[model samples]
Target: MASRLTQARNRVVDRMVNAPRDTDERALRRAVAGKTVLVTGASFGLGEATARTLARHGAIVLAVARTAERLDELVAAIEAEGGKAYAYPADLSDFDSIGPLADKMIAEHGGIDIVINNAGKSMRRSLDLQYDRFHDFTRMVNVNYLGPVRLLLAVLPHMRERGSGQIVNVSTIGVRIPPGPRWGVYQSTKGAFDIWLRSIAPEIKVDGIDVSTIYMTLIYTRMSAPTPSMRKLPGMSAKEASGLVTRAIIGREREITPWWVTPAQATDAVARGAVTWGMGILHRNSSDTASARGEAVR
Candidate 1:
C-alpha cells in the first residue's frame, strides 16, 4: 500500500513538472523550419541538446560556446544528420565581446529569430566558505546575469526592427522556490536575471517580440556535477529539458514551469518563516557534521 501511494504521488508530480512526453515531431519541425536560432553554452549539456534538437527541427542553429573543438564537433554531427548549424565560439563571461559577437551573428544570419540564454555558472559553496572568494559571486553575476543582458541589448534593435523575435531564458526553480543554503551565489544571480527578464517582457511584447522564462528543475548535466549528492536525486535529462525549450518555441508561452511549481511558490510565500527556520537548522546540522569529520564547512 505504501509503495503504491508513493508511486501515485510521483506520477502526479511528474505530470505537474514535465512537458508532455509525447511531442508532435512534425509540428515542432514546422514551427522552427528556416528560422535562425541562437543557443549559448551549446558545447555541452542542455545547451548542446537544445541546439541539436532545434537543428533537427530545421532551424538554422547558431551554436555558441567557449570551446571551438566541441562546437565544431557538434556542428559537424548536426550537418551529418542533414541539419543546419554553425559554430560560434565566444566566452559569454567576456562582457566587452558580446556586442561584436551579436553583430557578427546578425551580419552572418540576417538576424536571430530565437535567442536561448542558456549559458551560466553555478556555485554551491556556503557563504562562510566564500569569505576569501568574492570572485565566485562576481563570476556568477557576470555569466548568469550581465552576459545575457549585454547580448540581448546588442540584438534588441535588430529584433525590434523586424518586429518579431523570441527570447527564451533558461532559468532555475530556485528563483521561484524557497531559497536553500549554500546556493546564495547561484540563486541570487539567477534571480537577478529572472526578475530583469520579467520586467522587460511586457515592453518587448508590444513590438511582437516574445519572451519566455522556463523555471527549470534539477537536470542531469555537467553544471550540476559538482554536487555529488545531486547525482542520486531524481532529475530531468538534457533531452527532456530541451523539449521544454522546443515547446516554448512552438507555444510562445510567457512562462513554463513544472505543474506543481505554482502550488510550491504559493506555499513558499505562505510559509516563509517556517521554511527559513527549517533551512537554518539544516545548515547548522551540515556544518556540525563537517566539523565532526574535521572537514572544512564549504
Candidate 2:
C-alpha cells in the first residue's frame, strides 16, 4: 500500500514537470525582439528563463553556464522555437577564464547590447561552521563578486566603443535584510558585489552604459527550496522577474523591482533586530529540514 502511494505521488510530480514544456508558456515572440543579450548562469533557474524569454522575443541570446548539457538543451529549445542563441560553458567561479570567454562570444556573435550577470553561488551555513569551512566564503566571493566584475571589465570596452550598453547585476534582497542563522558566506559575498556595483556605477554612467543592480526576492527555482514560512510568503516568479529585467535592460531603468522593496529596505534600517529575530524563527525550521534530508541521503 505504501509503495503504491509513493508511485502515485511520483506520477503526479512527473506530470507537473512535463506540463510546462508541452504547452509553451513562451512569450518569446514579444520580449526580446531585435536585442542581443548575454545571460550568465543560463543553464538553470532564473537565468534559463530570462534567456528563453529574450530569445522568443527575437533577440539573439548568448547563454553561458558551467553545465554544457543544460546549455546545449537551452540552445536547442530556442532554435526549435525559431530563435537565435549561442551557448558557452565556463564556470563563473574561475575569474581567470573570463577574458577568453568574452572574446569567444564577441567573435561568434559580436558584442551584446545587454549583459545579465545573473550567475551566482548561494549556500546557507552558520557562523560556527565558517571557521572550519572558510573556503565556502572564499569561493562564493570569487564567483559572485569577482567573476561579474571581470566579465564587466571585458565586455565594457566593446560596449563603450559602440557608445551604448546595459548591465543588470543580479544581486539579492538578502543584503537588505541580513536574514540569518545561516548564509554567513552567501550574504557577505553578494553584499560585496552590491557595494562594488554601486561604487562603480557613477564612472560608467557617462559612457552611455547603465549599470543596474537588481535585488531579488525569493523566486520559484530549484535552488530556492525555502522553509514553510518563506514558501508561504509571496515570492516572485521567474517570469515576472524576467519582465522587470527586460524593462531595466531595454529602458535603462536605474533600478527595478516590485513595490514591496521600499518597505523591506526601510524595515531593515529601522527595526533590524525584529527582522533578525523573525529570520531566526525561519532558520530554525530550515535547519531541521536540512538535517533530516541530509540523514536520509546518507
Candidate 3:
C-alpha cells in the first residue's frame, strides 16, 4: 500500500514537472539518418539511452566518456542491436584531451553532423563543507563548463565549413529556476554554459548551425542514485529523458524547458530576497551528507 501510494504521488509530481513531448520515431530517424552524432557521457544513464536511440534511428553514434570499458559495452550493445556505434574514452574534465578527441572524431568520421553536450558532474555540498574543498568548484567548472566549451571550439569550425549541424546542451532545470541550497557549485557551472551557449546562438545560427538547450528535470540514473532525496522525488526514466534529447534534435528548437519554468522564473525574479532567505533557513536546518564530509558510502 505504501509503495503504491508513493508511485501514485510520484506520477502526479512527474506530470507537474515534466512537460509532455511528442516524438515521431520516423521523423527522428529521418532527421538523423546517415549523420554522425556524437554523445558525451555516453557510457551511462541519459547519454547512453540517447546514443542508443539515435543509433537505432540510423545515426552513426560516437559514444564518449571517461570509462573505456563502459563505452565499449555501450557500443557493443548498440551494434548488437544492428546499429552503428564507436567508443571514444576520454575524461571531459581533462581539458587538454578534448581538442584531440574532436580532431580524431572529425578525421575518422569526416565531420560530425550533431553534437550532444550531455556530459556533466553533479555536486551537492553545503558551503560549510565546501570551504575546505575548493577542488569541488574547479572540478564542476572544468567538467560542466570549460570542457564542453573547448570541444565546441574544436568542432565549430568544421560545422561552420559544412554550413549545417545541430548542437544540443543537456542542461539542468536548476539553471532555469530558483536555485536552492547545497547546489551552488553545480548550478553555477551549468548556468555559465547555458548563458554562454545562448549568447553565441545568434552568431552560430548565421552559419546554419542550430543550437538547442534542454533544461532537463531530474532523471533516475546512477548519477542521481546517491542522493537520498532524489530517490524519493519523482523523475523521468533514462529512456524518457533521451526522448527529450531526440525531440531537440528533430525540432531544433532554441530551448526546451518545463511548462512551469516561466512562472517560476517570474516568481524568483520578484521574490528573490524571500527565496534566498528561505533557502538560507533550509541550509541552516539541513546537514551535509556523509560523502560531502569525505566519508565513504557503504
TM-score to native of every candidate shown: 0.90, 0.81, 0.94
Model 1, 1-298: lDDT tens per residue? 5698897986776666664543578988888999999999999999999999889889999999899999999999999999999999998889899999999999999999999999887767777677777777778898899999999999989998999999999999888888899888899999999999999998989999999888888788977876677776667889978988888888888888777777777887899888899899988876422322233322
Our tally of clashes for model 3 stands at: 0
Model 1, which residues run further than 4 Å from truth? Answer: 1-13, 16-22, 287-298
Give candidate 3 regions above 4 Å deviation.
1-12, 295-298
Order the candidates by TM-score, highest first — what do you get? 3, 1, 2
Q: Estimate every model's Cα lDDT from 0 to 1.
A: 0.86, 0.75, 0.90
| lDDT, candidate 3, 55-85, per-residue tens | 9999999999988999999998989989999
The regions of model 2 sitting more than 4 angstroms off are 1-32, 226-229, 272-298
lDDT of 2 by residue, 33-139 (tens): 67689999899888998898888778899999899999999999999999999889998767889999998887777777889989887776556555666567677
Ranking, lDDT, top scorer first: 3, 1, 2
lDDT score for residue 213 of model 3: 94
Better of 1 and 2 by TM-score: 1
Better of 1 and 3 by lDDT: 3
